[model samples]
Target: MIGVYISILILLAIIVYLYFTKRLSYLLKSKRKLLFKSLNKVEKWFLAGSLIATFTFSTLTNLVSSVIYELVSPNSNKEFLKIDEKQDTSIELISESNEKLDKLLKDASIDPRDIEQYLKNLPLKDGKEETNARIDEWYQARKISLEIKELLLVVTKVIFEQNEDLTNTITFLKSTGKTDFAGVLENIQKYFQEGDAEKIKQEYFSRKEKVEKENILILKQSIKSTEALFAFQQTVDLYKELILVEPTAENYFQTAYFLHKLKYFDEAANLYQKTLKIYRDLAQENPRAYLPNVAETLNNLADLHSDKNEFPQAQEKYEEALKIRRDLAEENPIAYLPDVATTLNNLAYLQNVKNEFSQAQEKCEEALEIRKKLAKENPKTYQSDVAMTLNNLAILHSEKNEFPQAQEKYEEALKIYRNLVQENPRTFLPDLAMTLSNLAILQNAKNEFPQAQEKYEEALKIYRNLAQENPRTYQPDVAMTLNNLAVLHWSKNEFPQAQEKYEEALKIQRDLAQENSRAYEIDYARMLIMGVKLFKKDKSNLKIAKGILERYQEVYSAQELLKLIRKLE
Candidate 1:
């Protein structure tokens, strides 16, 4: 019985220690609460009752011990317990010091008096040194933050002022159609004049991507406005700056497009080749994602080659694009078949240029068949394509001297255009005019002079109206019609009328050549040659024609001009 009592006492002592330290409760709380809640109501009640009994027993034991101690020592002169003065004071000091240190760490704005007292009372050398080092670090951090704030304010002010000036300048430019770039030019020049050239270049280059994006937006706006050519050139300049920053494929391609439009064919082709190489590498990595872009670039490159008269290169590029389009069409016919048809048409045009008539006809036929099916499904959308293909076929027939077949196709195309114009005259009038011109040429070839003249007059009227509205794009068309008229009169031996028409055509061609000599110079030289032929009978007229030809010595072959001069002498 005594042993059992001692075991119970030991267990009670362990329970008391665990309860005071919270270890037993902490272990229960750390487990999932759901496990305790899973007990039945009776089991929960039993556990509560047992905990209450244990607490009562512990309290009774503590009270009994105190009572016994009071009775047993009531008469003793000394007290049962005495506090240790030094050790108790030491513990109190440690507790106070810990509270003060915690407060200081938690509150950065503690009273200075309290902080001084606390630091002075710090008992260890290492603690004092550590606190001092932390304070120094805090001071340095604050100093750096203040300096950064000041620098930011200065930079913000400078940027705001520059932005305000730039905004006002841009508003002025827009209001004035940007015809005078003097103010903007001055603003750009000011940067160079005020700063080191290398520094200014670096600054411009650092923001070059942003500058390129903004310039591209401006270029789009300029294209819609009357100052498109000037804006295009400015955009090209921006692209050059972007290249200086980073010669990216997209930047090169953008520059190439503008260069092509500006008639800088060689430069445009070089850039396009660079873009093509980059796209090719990218396509090799992810063909499905990038092959369409490759095909588009190839198409543009082919057109560029065609414009430059690099026929073989153009043919090769067009064929490559066609093969890609064919593959894409096979994968998703509904979405990509139109691209296939378009590529076929472009290839056909190229073949026609190369005088590969049989191949050209086959490609044209295939394209027409696709377009016809597409038109049958959605006439409103694809009818124009069908008519365009018909016109192309008619031209091919005419080139082959199959007059009846050419006339049939021309009439078919004309009917389509006429119907289309009835629905939207502004859009389709140009097509009607083009078909009329073709018909007039066909009539002239067949010696139907009166009908040819009537058709030519009608086409000229349309071209004149179009040129009056947008002279930059359509003025050359007017010159072309005038040249055709001159040829018609020349064929009939109406030298005086032919000479007048040729002179008018030459004047327009001269003006066009002033803007793009490579595009218009050959036409100007041809007009001079026609003038020479028309005025051969009159010595004074012959001398005038010879002088005009000599003036374009670079455009015309010297040998050919000399032969003409010898004939005239």
Candidate 2:
């Protein structure tokens, strides 16, 4: 009996120790800055290393920075992801002069084939004359989004103009009959005119997301009547309004979401921050209610930062989002597991960027497993997700130099997308093209030049066909594929072939950049830079390459020109 009592006492003591130690470890992890280096590394320098002085300094710097970062952030170590955002300025779309708008209005309606095919698809009862007029009006509204989006900026400036001479601007707005943009402007004008701006903000802006979802849905419905022109401004103004509304996290998040879609990174970043700040507080108060939003906002903010190349911020946000989603998934796997997979896939991509291939592989595998399970449950909803994760995994494997695994993953993803395309050609066709292009890249990396060429040609063909139907959406893909093909040709020492591809790709990119610089300039510049690399060693060839970029000195902004020159050097 005494021996049994003694065993019970020891077991109780062990349990008590574990409970306290667990609590203590949590506190330490959150509060303390752990040393980054291994004792083995320190001991090697101490005992057997030759460059003690140099290695020691580097070691101390790492350690110091770790502690300093801990102090600076008061947050845990955040993983960094690559920024995917391009050089989109505050003003994304641009129109140099008011003349562009006048010319746009004067331009002929779109092709008769386009109008006829579109009308054939829709149920229309109007006579040919009325139908043609409607098409012309709709055509102009469509052109505003593509040909000269910056006209809206000018329109806004005109709307805000206090000066009495608003005749031409008014006439221009009135001319946009299909969009009813003038009437939309009048509503804004009347609202501003009627209300005290501060009072309007106090009442409207203070209203949180819960009360505004219905309004947001109504705004979406408004998208049909106003099209892209009015929808972009009105939706952005609704939940996303700045000076007129108070900072509502949902509102700001929604606003930032639209802005990000519009490639307004600078504006999006500020609004995302406002959303995050509020969401963080709300999450702290009610994790169950608001934590998902916190994770969502973090995910988007991380993506925004990633686009901007702010890797550190991206890492921190992705990790936090991953953690939150994991927790949420544990509580409700059906709802949150997909989110967990998405965050994991994101982290995997970032890890690949950081050259942590093993870590990336693990995350990709985990994401693949989760997505596969989800796809099994709801194949229609999650099949694409599975393919996406497989694609990401394939990239990770390629980065790790596991060629066979990469090839297998890529093929699996390609097969899935091919099958999907059979059911929904329009939606899945792009995915098919994307996977082909990626596989072609992998083939290039492996020096299977023939296979690479075949894949590139296939992707190029798809993109070319898609671009014919939707140039605004798919032309960039055409340029990208052409550039990649150029690189492949250059690798094969086919200088003439490479040069032809490069020039063709550059021409397409130039036209696209002119149409929408915010969307395409970085791509154009990057392709030019890549093309220049081909002639880096040959002085004569290099001069010609430099000439290609230099010819456009007048076209690019001073800042852009300088940056390109520096990059070239």
User: Which number leads on lDDT?
Assistant: 1
Can you list the residue pairs that collide in candidate 2?
A: 79-315, 83-306, 83-309, 84-306, 84-307, 85-307, 205-246
* Model 2 TM-score (2 dp): 0.54
lDDT of 2 by residue, 1-569 (tens): 33344445555554464355454353346542232222247543542343344455556766777788777874311210100011011112211222244433322222212322343332223323453455456546664233223333333333233211222323544653312333433443333333222322333334334334322222322221121122244435544444233455755765677677556899898988888888889888888999999899899989988887788889999999999999999999999999999999988888787788898899999999999999999999999999998998988887778989999999999999999999987668888999999999999988999999999999999989877655766788899999999999999999899889988998999899788765666566566566556745333433444555555566444346446556666
Query: Residue 95 error for model 2, in Å?
Result: 27
TM-scores, all candidates, are 0.54, 0.54
Q: Which stretches of candidate 1 lie over 4 Å from their true place?
A: 1-234, 241-249, 377-380, 467-539, 550-569
Q: What is the C-alpha RMSD of each candidate to the true structure, in Å?
A: 28.1, 24.6
Q: Whole-model lDDT for model 1 versus the true structure?
A: 0.65
- lDDT per residue for candidate 1 within 1-569, as digits (tens), equals 33345447756665575567555574467753653555569756765665666666766767777788878866222210111222223223323343443332222322222332332322222333454454445446663232222222332233233334435545654554553332433344344223222333333434445544333333222221211111233345555654555476765776676577567899889988998899899999999877887887898899899998899999899999889888888888778778888989998998998898889988998999999888998899999999999999989989989999889888898999999999987668778899999999999999998888888889899988867544655678789988899889989989788878878888999899778765666566556665666655345544554565566666536448647666856
